[model samples]
Target: MTDCGCDKAKAELEEYLHNELCSTDAEDIREHLAGCVDCESELHVGRVLTEAVQRACRETAPGDLRDQVLLKIRTIQATH
Candidate 1:
């Protein structure tokens, strides 16, 4: 298996992180990352940022804010 090189690996890193790449492409990235410290570090950073974003997405709005937004939506719907 040839190393897919840093350019392709970095370009597809996000897709690889999200498991959106086909197996062949993912494998190429995996192999490249295995031998390349810079790409591996980049992958680590991507993992961290993804995790942070996931955590942020999982958080709910404060109760009062949620209620206010819902009320506004309902009012707009009522008028329309």
Candidate 2:
């Protein structure tokens, strides 16, 4: 949401969040995040989004539904 559209910063953020960044890049992002209010806000939003998705996923699929999926997989595997 910054004037630059924050593309470079957002890329860094995506990598940082996934723990896929190299040490130097991660440190640079960490420094930027500490000093830049805009990027910090973006990072906070990203964390909230990640947490919300995790919580939502936990609420999906009943035990019976999982059994049904496993049963279907077994049926297909048996055919092939």
Candidate 3:
């Protein structure tokens, strides 16, 4: 496992939050976080933001959005 100082740890923190890091990198970040208060706090913030974004992104579009989009596309194509 490589050593990650504060900068590298902070940079990869979002990946860590999503559990997307490889074992070596994850462990390095974990070890860094254990000893770093600022990074820990940043990790918490990252988690909150990531979860909020994920929730927002998972929402389905309005019921008629697809129909509306298709209608618009068809209209444009007909005009062309």
Clashes of 1: 0
Candidate that scores best on lDDT: 1
Model 2 stretches astray by more than 4 angstroms: 1-7, 63-80
Using TM-score, rank the candidates from best to worst: 1, 3, 2
TM-score: model 1 vs. ground truth: 0.81
Q: CA lDDT, every prediction?
A: 0.97, 0.80, 0.91
lDDT of 2 by residue, 9-70 (tens): 67778778888887777777777777778898999999899889889988968889999999
| Stretches of candidate 3 exceeding 4 Å from the true structure | 1-3
Worst 10 residues of 3 by lDDT: 1-10
lDDT of 3 by residue, 1-80 (tens): 66698999999987898789998999999999998999999998988998899999999888799889989999999999
Per-candidate total of colliding backbone pairs: 0, 0, 0
Instruction: Tell me the tens digit of each residue's lDDT in model 1 across 14-51.
Output: 99999999999999999999999999999999999999
Considering summed lDDT, which 10 consecutive residues are worst modelled in model 2? Answer: 1-10
- Pairs of colliding residues, candidate 1: none
